[model samples]
Target: MLTGQKRKFAIALMSGSTQAAAAIKAGYSEKSARSKGSQLAKDPDVIAYMHKTRGVEESANPEVTKQKVEPEKMPVVNTLTGDFDDPLDFLKSIMNDRSEETDVRKDAAKAMLPYVHAKKGEGGKKDAKLGAAKAAHSKFSGMAPPKLVVNNKG
Candidate 1:
């Protein structure tokens, strides 16, 4: 039922891209892609078609599952003890040790960054971007949108 940019946009949407991004991917002009994508996604027929195609894709590829792991949830082991341990503690110690090689300490701090809280407004800006993306996605898909939880402060 869809062709040209519509078809390409739908395909992109099914691949987890936001509608606006999909529009641009489908060859829509950058100046209007966001609005065009939003408009296309808001169409009932487009939503229905997407859901139908998604259903077929899901059935055909039943083994596919998205990996949604957060860094903190990843299992870390202390090699010395051969036991589970908080990786953040190791990173923090490395960062605080003035005698450690500068590069090594820098690497440790960089690694610890994901565990650090964002400075005030930084999180808000990220959330706003995510919101726009989600809004575009939810408009065209007849499914619940996934929520992104950002933990900025340690």
Candidate 2:
């Protein structure tokens, strides 16, 4: 019974979008979106659609609450699970997944970046062989040379 826009509104609501936002996404007029969303949410057809899609039984259910119920949480992928081919692939997937939390995605990106791109040390050009050599020279610059004449007395 739900039309295309109404169905879309229900789906957007199920996906955790606010009523006003869901209405806008469903192609409702912005000026009256809030009122439209509130009315659409109370529509029996939209309610039925949402209930059907969520796999809830109309008969068994007593009262239908308007509160947002999020779907089951995705399992945390900390280590290299066999489901993915390798560690890099696994991390990349986590990083790219839009549904993932911002912090988690950032962590995944940090974990995956070293493998995909080379990590350069702090503040230097790509070819810093001369700088490295200078560092080594500086390391030994403090020590004085041994006394050659004293060694001859032995």
Q: What is the C-alpha lDDT of each candidate?
A: 0.68, 0.76
Per-residue lDDT of candidate 1, residues 1-89 (tens digit): 45556767866776778778989999999999889999988776566555544433334453442322233443343233333288888
Residue 14, candidate 1: how far off, in angstroms? 1.4
Q: Write the per-residue lDDT of candidate 2 for residues 1-154, one digit (tens) a residue.
A: 5678987898789879989999999999999999999999899988976775565656544555454556453123344335976888888888887655466688899888878887676456745887776768865477777867556665
Candidate achieving the largest lDDT: 2
Native-to-model Cα distance after best TM-score fit, residue 124 in candidate 2, in Å: 84
Off by over 4 Å in 1: 56-154
Q: Give the CA lDDT, 0 to 100, for residue 35 in model 1.
A: 95
As for candidate 2, its clashing pairs are none
